[model samples]
Target chain A: MAERVMAEAVFDDLIHPSTRLSIVALLASADWADFAFVRDRLGLSDSALSKQFATLEDAGYVHIERPVTQHRRRVRVRLTDTGRRAFVGHVAALQEVISTAKLGARSD
Target chain B: MNGQVSESEARLALDAVEARRQQVAAEIDVPGWYWWSVAAGWVVLGALATFAPVWASAVGTVGFGALHAAVAPRVISGRRGSSRLSVRRDLVSRRVPFLVLGFLVAMVALTTAIALVLDADAARHPALLASGIVAALVVTGGPLLMSWVRRRAVRRLSA
Candidate 1:
């Protein structure tokens, strides 16, 4: 698959919150993650994780799927292309912030 | 968000991101069962060579090879090591399957060498003894190989 080029140094408000940033960072390394896996990994309660997922879903940053299996229903979460781009850009922006501060410190 | 956040906070967030990436990197492994099964199969093949007829031994080796071929493709990528998530291919080395296959081939050579040494010493059941030794290696060395893979993943992520 052809990956879209990430935008440069663009800060994203929707994803900047610590909780959401952690979620996105985890998902960025996976193709799809089980809800329980994300919840347990982040040490968040189901309701709390659901609330965060709902927010990200509304922002079109993530796609949630309920796959029916013989055992039970599973919620699988995937980062959307837009979300990946936003995340990549947000990380770049964070690095830029640090570098600019370093430059200012060097000048001073 | 960037405007209000201080440099130290950005650094911290970046650190957190790296931590999460490392967590995913840790997940890059073959399941524990895969190693056990391979080890068990190796021992079984060794047993067959020791006691079974020539045709039976040949068939057992071929059948074992077939089973391994079927299963290796799915697990060798080190992506689906857990039921929780399928790791992104970019997070794993493309050389994973090659590394695993290379390790197995080396094990085969080791087994042969051990068996030959034992046979020269006029030891009983040389094939069985050799296979048992290598099976132990498979169970132990397999996890070590994956740990090495995980370290490589962490290093690449940090880079």
Candidate 2:
């Protein structure tokens, strides 16, 4: 399938790290995900997941909400619009890198 | 340009992104309880049709329909199969609920036809027999339908 080449292909340094990238990529496909679910799915410890979430939250790329339900509080995470844009831009940037290298090899 | 990353590394990153999307796509399903409940209700309605008074059977059918209507909105998208996450609306087909409902409607029609044939052949408890057959199909076929949905979601993501 052809890649979706966005007009703005900005490489986001904050989201380039492997762990953060995985988290963002997962969130990109979900409206909102439970904190525990994300942690379990990625095989990360609570502390480790919290640390990553804090980094994303500080960057305005993710929002954390603690909602009360059934007399219990649950943590849910969703990517902000800014974060979604950054992720899309980052993916486009990655695709560009590959395509540019392929073009260079073909020219040679 | 991401000068620090080589072409192979960029490719790997993109692959990882796709993998994550596939993981979410895999979650496209209705909860197991939804199937079980529907199957049980079908059998009960069938039993009512066979042995109960006509009014009782009518009420049972109406009750089942009302219950399904109440619950379908939340589960029919095959998005909240798990409480962990709700699949993004754009990622799932909007017609999934309709597909499920349509499948049920077809089953109802099939049951009526089967019962008619059984009665014509002088079989006893035709309604019960027909409902049992359709209920079995519902229990087994529901999950298969959701699996097809998940595969479609993955294919859409890959595309």
Candidate 3:
């Protein structure tokens, strides 16, 4: 029961925001993706994507790289190990919350 | 942050996770060049096998297989899609290699069966005919087939 409570407490506020959660979820599946790809997929404006990237970067949840390819600069994003851990924990916490709710409803 | 999360919010969050995962799965694709190269290679190899001497054809087959083995790993690693972003290693299904191998085996078997059937019909250049048919399939359906296979693999992994 104590473990259940601790597990429920593992929700990550940093990743709880919908936009940030979406970003982390996408990054969780790939090693790295370009900025344009994420923006296009998420249907976010360049500025909006950049702002989200900055927020995740500040939290050390994502690493951004700007590399020049054939004289063209491109930004790439990837989830950090710490970010992955946080996302996984938050997901587990969410699952726990749902399961606990289901159990409580059944008891009542 | 320590406040209790409501059941509804938790369910919503879980839905978000699934949605994001689906987005990633949808993005799992080999670059366009992969399909095009495969099509070209199929035609080239088919032509070579049709025209070359048996020894030469054997050498070509071995050489092409070796080249594919060497280069295909980099291309099919699911690292990069049409976008500049590289996919994460964990998200990539380990069954990818098997999927590719199975696809190749099926293609080879189809080509061989076509050749045998045409040969039985006394058709001239049965091998060439088989190659043309297989090459056409590769050009037209390779990408779609790859996409379908990747989706299935992702579904299996997620399950």
> For this target, which candidate reaches the highest lDDT against the unseen true structure?
1
What lDDT score goes with residue B155 in model 2?
91
Q: Which docking category, incorrect, acceptable, medium or high, applies to candidate 1?
A: medium
Enumerate the candidates' DockQ scores in order: 0.60, 0.64, 0.52
| Model 2: residues with Cα > 4 Å off, grouped in runs | A1-7
Q: Model 3, B11: alpha-carbon shift in Å? A: 1.2
lDDT of each: 0.91, 0.90, 0.76
Q: Comparing candidate 1 with candidate 2, which one achieves the higher lDDT?
A: 1
Question: Model 3, residue B37: what's the lDDT?
Answer: 72
Q: Candidate 1, B6: how far from true, in Å?
A: 1.8
Per-residue lDDT tens digits of candidate 3, residues A2-85?
Answer: 011123347898898888888888787777888988897789999999998998899998999998989999998888887877
lDDT (Cα, 0-100) at B45 in candidate 1:
92
Any residue pairs clashing in model 2, and if so which?
none
Off by over 4 Å in 3: A1-9, B77-79, B153-159
- Per-residue lDDT of candidate 2, residues B1-159 (tens digit): 779789998999998898888898899999988988998998899899999999999999999999999989998899998888988887789989999999899999999999999999999999999999999998899899999999998998788
Please give each candidate's TM-score.
0.91, 0.91, 0.86
Winner by DockQ between candidate 3 and candidate 1: 1
Error of 1 at B124 (Å): 2.3
Give the per-residue Cα lDDT of candidate 1 at B116.
Answer: 100
